[model samples]
Target: MKRVFVTVGTTSFDELIERVTTPEATQALKARGYQHLVLQVGRGSILPDSDSCHELTLEVFRFKDSIAEDIKCADLVISHAGAGSCLETLGAGKPLLVVVNDQLMNNHQLELADQLYQDAHLLYCTPSTLIETLKMMDLSVLSPFLPGKPKNFADFLDKALGVQ
Candidate 1:
């Protein structure tokens, strides 16, 4: 049985949570043999009154001082497209499925998720395609996420301060 960790960063991403905890999604997840779902919802509003978590063992909370424990315990991760969440999940070598929040200004999360998917670093889906996307994947064979060398913090500092 696989454990899934869902994180939405430090802001409210109720919409993302709603999509995953929907009845359709629960059915699909159960069929896929997932046994547990742990959600780090931040300040999100949570699911609709009519929605339920189905038969799976469910653990959801508003926040955690550190998401490391939750991420480390999971077989799979479902995350918002924030860079921190995406990179952390990848660094941990966990299978990841990203859902970009289109409600953000300029659809910035969409850009991040799109680029990551293009690189084969992670799978991505929108709210409407969440269930369908999960249905199509073979998580057992997820590719390793290998990130490029990061720029030095000094480089960023210099660039930001216009100091060459």
Candidate 2:
């Protein structure tokens, strides 16, 4: 069975789950009989309203130390579009689906998502488009876009300072 790991708001797991209509999405996976699904709701308690929908396990407020290991073991990762999560998912060479927080006032995430998407580097979704995006995601089409390693902070400072 294929496994999917989903990480969302720590304190808002219940709210986030409530917002997701995964039953429809899971239907596709269910048809294939792939039922190993896990939700790691960091910093958030599991809501009673969330339905398991097949072989699904819900963990609330998981230890911070275990997150990387959990991500490493999963076949696919579903997470928020925070820069940290994006970088980690990319570093692991895992396919990712990022759902940006709409409540964020400035809409910076939209810009970031657009840039990443334009570069063909990451998959992203807003609340309005999440279901459609999930249905259409082509994991094979994603590829790593690693920036060249910088020599050092001092080198960067020297260049910025115009010092020979």
Candidate 3:
């Protein structure tokens, strides 16, 4: 059985869980025989009220130091559509399913999600389409989207500053 690591935002696990209208998607995956490890890192405004499941294990307030290692060790990653999380997952060369936060009246996450989706880099899902998206994940089709360290903004700063 393959293992899937799901990491919600660092600052709103409770809000995330409350806003997540369809947690059955996660439950369905577990029912289908996948090992699901759900971790809530940092202090999130949202969180699940309970941590009971047949195949899902939920952890709250996990250490940041261990997040990278968890990402590296997981076969697939499920996370929110924060730039930091997206970039890190891409850097790890792992396929990711990103769920953007829509309740915040923000479009940045949605924009990022669209860009990554178009780039064939990460799978993006909105709350409405989450279940279908999860069902369609074919790990065999996953390829390394982002490789190695990303360019530092400072590297471009020189050109922007016109300093040769």
Q: Pick the candidate with the highest lDDT.
A: 1
For model 1, how many clashes? 0
TM-score of 1: 0.81
User: By the lDDT metric, which is better: model 1 or model 2?
Assistant: 1
Candidate 2 residue-pair clash tally: 4
In the range 1-164, model 2's lDDT, one tens digit per residue, is: 56666777344434444444367666644443445666666666554333555434434344475577767877777777666666677678777777777776475656765677777787877766766776677777887868646668779899999999
**Candidate models: Cα lDDT each:** 0.80, 0.64, 0.66
List RMSD in Å for every model shown: 4.6, 3.7, 4.3
- Sliding window of 10 residues with minimal summed lDDT for model 3: 13-22
Candidate number of the best TM-score = 1
lDDT of 1 by residue, 1-164 (tens): 68989899989888878878877887788888888888888887773332256657788787778898888889889998888888889888888998877677476656766787887778877777888987787765557877565667778888999996
Cα displacement (angstroms), candidate 2, residue 162, comes to 13
TM-score of each: 0.81, 0.73, 0.70
lDDT of 3 by residue, 41-101 (tens): 4566544544554446555454476578778877778787777788888888877888766
Which pairs clash inside model 1? none
